[model samples]
Target: MTVPVRPDARRNATPYLYGREAAAVARVLESGQYGHSDVTEQFERRVANWLGVPEAVSVSSGTAALHAAFLAAGVGPGDEVVVPSMTFCATIQAILATGATPRFVDIDPDTLCVTGDLLMEAVTDATAAVAPVLFGGRAVDLSSVQGEFDRRGIVVVEDAAHAFGSRDGSRPVGAGGTALTCFSFGPIKNLTCGQGGMVIPRSPQEAERLRRLRLLGVVQSQNERADITTYHVDSFGLRYQLSSINAAIGLAQLDRFATTERVRRRLWRAYRQALAQVDGVTLVDVDVDRAVPHLCQVRVPRRDEVFAELRARGIGVGVHYPPNHRQPAFAAWRRSLPATERAGAEILSLPFHQHLTRDDIDHVASELERALKTTGGS
Candidate 1:
């Protein structure tokens, strides 16, 4: 797991920077407002309006966003949160941070999302919430399970880290009124704010609580940066406030959506066309025109072999996940997830970013065929 630092072999495997990102940082630096300030509030308002949400609470990271949402939802010791095993470990860790149990659930194999049926079967009297992820930026089909979640009174905390710009028909992913929806602005995510996240809260009350939780539970306003002598602490909180500098970069990235999304769409379409009937390889319906993808992954029979082959040939391939249930640290939370286990073994994420050229797409596709041949895959 320890990859030696190889500065010389740097690969642009994630969403690369647009020209204005540095300027954004510089503006924040020169303003001398490094702490959480008006710029942070401005970014939150823009994000909330963009998502059509009443309140958007900006935080330190996507994991922190998830943690804050869980706490706001009252998920604590002894409560169970049903989550898909086919997701990042952050989902499990976020729940654990609240002293709650994470119940691993299998995906629907086809959509690679936890279906309403699977979710229904996983819950119990102790179930407090279900955090469904928009995996690889694929929109989760919530239609089937929305009724059940309402009837059961289970809070839906959508993990929309990958679904930042994705839309459902005409509605944006985070705009829906869920208990909470989290977005990431990590270095590798579609939108980068150095390292930050934003949570679209269901109510103004929850929004206020999240703001308090992010700054050591000290209930204070942004204007209090000038007069911090007076404040009140209600309960436990953490130092999870996103700096103004980070928020500036995020604001800049939001402005670049028009150009950045186009590059992603073009390259993603190129990959889709090039790999169209490769024998043993299967791709999810990325619908790049509609969804802004964070990764372009495929399911290949000899995935490990293919993963190694591509990387050996200077192609930066990756694995989106190794099922949460299979992790030794989360052994106590283990449960049988056949589809998740099988998919984890076969999933392969190819190098995807605005930096990739059409030639790069062809090369990756051609090399995939070569790898499949050597591994005895059709």
Candidate 2:
């Protein structure tokens, strides 16, 4: 007897490459201009336009973008940056990288984002910034919280790794925020550039500072001559510049973003409609009109057992993240985060992407229903 292999639930065809991404890479390769070049500039312009911001700086990774944002925002040692405990470790690590403490805050179980009430409680005299993470492509309403932070002179940085196309009201995620906003273009993100990130500054001054910081604090002189170098290092900086090759890919990804987002929303609705009646499972509340739906996540009982059952049936499932405070590195910050802990244990990410079909969703729903039944949920 032979064991049967289930179809891969994670299968995606061609990976949604940008139309000109390959050409851009090939152009760079042929020109031998691998470092930051005109292509990078073009990519920045495109991203800025897309977000309706004045400036955008491409970086090596999303974490790098966050670190740079912290520095640009003047968050330093001994300062505390309020962050959600339910977010990925990168958000906390970025604060640590800036020599700042990550003060963990609880999340809203309905929205899966840091609640304003919880954030207010966490704010202290030592607090320098608040990073409102947009989880699973859900738009976080930072407008009201922005006023609170502004009154206290606290900066608000958006951890929009999963929110490339997320919008609040009529504005995009990166726009209309007084604080710095960071976006990820990682392979798994809504937008893919293999591995890249960007920082959208609130002003031109911030943008200039970020550009210098990205390239080792080196500012170019007007002469454009290497012999007459002006080695002015205003502040500590890091090498977080994105390559032209990656920018080309990013540009391509941007072109197809609108289509991909549409597909994602459709899939999310399909899941909600199909699994609405499933016992012990509740879909996250999201504003489909503004959100792009990065991942279709839900709170379910017996999450581990359900995850295992899905895997056994050739369905690929995922957890958005574990509580960041619970990580060993942040043990000192690990206090009781009831909502985060509960979400960690009960949340399950169903297979959702541009490639998933209606049939695929049906199969997932069937497997999930069976899993719930197996766990004694009538």
Candidate 3:
């Protein structure tokens, strides 16, 4: 099979940059208004409108978005926030940063995302929030989960670190109907801003609170928009505001969203088609039609050996996550999560970037078959 190799396949997380990004940064530099100004605000608006949310507040990182969302929802020390064990450690760390305990729950083996049932089971009187991550861009069907959790007064926050341009049928992932949604614009995401995140709160009040919390707890009224303005400090906050420099890059990515999303979706579809015929591997359950996946992950036999083989063959493969429960930082919270363990032990991530071509997918599949039959592999 012909291999359409990436120019920079060695680095897995590098974002593709167009000249518009440089132009935006240059404009910011020329304006001399660098710290969270109109440019950054415009970027926030674009993302908010893109997600079909009323408002979105930008933060320094996706982790900060989670922390701000929890803090805005009144989560604090002693409160337990339920999340899946099969996510990036950022989810666990964000809860910890808010002085809340993270209760790691098992995921649905098919979707590789925590189910609402699992979250509900983990909840107790101390439970204040439940964040359902869109595992590998797989949309979480929160319809049933939200109503039940809402009755119990549990706050649901959708973590879309891997599902930026994704939609669930007709609705966008973070749109008005669902709970508050969070997105990461980290270098490897479907959309990247070098490093940034946002919170799509439900109401104007929630947006205001998030804005204040993100900007060192100051009043986020019109006064703060000026170059130098005095605002009353209401409470404690963190320096989690996204800078103009980062937003500029993100805006560039957003400008070309249609093209990028089409490419990403096409690449993923090619992987699904090719992998369907391969033995000893299967995709996690997801609505591929609506999913603009951030990675093309497949559960393969002898995952580690395959991972090594792909790396040796010059393919940038990764494990989306290693299950946060087993991490040393959450050692005390560690426990058996059967489905999560299954996913962690067998999952292999292949490159699924906007730059990938159908030939690359075929090359990867052809190479993967060879690796799966080697010694110590199934």
Candidate 3 TM-score over all chains jointly: 0.94
* Candidate 2 residue spans exceeding 4 A from truth: 1-15, 221-230
**What's the lDDT of the predicted structure labeled candidate 1?**
0.84
lDDT string for model 1 (1-378, tens) is 333322212264754787888898898899998979888989999898877878899999999999999998888999999999888899899999999999889997765777678887899898999988888887776777788788888898888888788886678888777558899999888888989998988888998889888989887776874577678888889888999999998899989887777877787788888999788888866656678888888899878887786676666788989999999989998999999999999988877877777877787888788879988876
Instruction: Quantify all predictions' global Cα lDDT against the true fold.
Output: 0.84, 0.83, 0.82
User: What does candidate 2's lDDT look like per residue over 1-378, in tens digits?
Assistant: 232333545453225564677886898899998878888889999999988888899999999999999999999999999999888888998999889998999899888898677888899999999998989887777666778888888988889998889887888888875768899988878898878999999888999889888988877622243567456777677899998888888888888888878887888899988887787789887677789878888888888888887677677788889888888899997778898898999898888777777877877887788878988653
lDDT (Cα) of model 2: 0.83
- lDDT of candidate 3 at residue 73, scale 0 to 100: 89
Q: All candidates' TM-scores?
A: 0.94, 0.94, 0.94
Error of 3 at 104 (Å): 1.2
Which residue pairs show collisions in model 3? none
For candidate 1, what is the TM-score?
Answer: 0.94
- Single out the weakest 10-residue window by summed lDDT for candidate 1: 1-10
- Candidate rank order under lDDT: 1, 2, 3
Question: TM-score of the candidate numbered 2?
Answer: 0.94
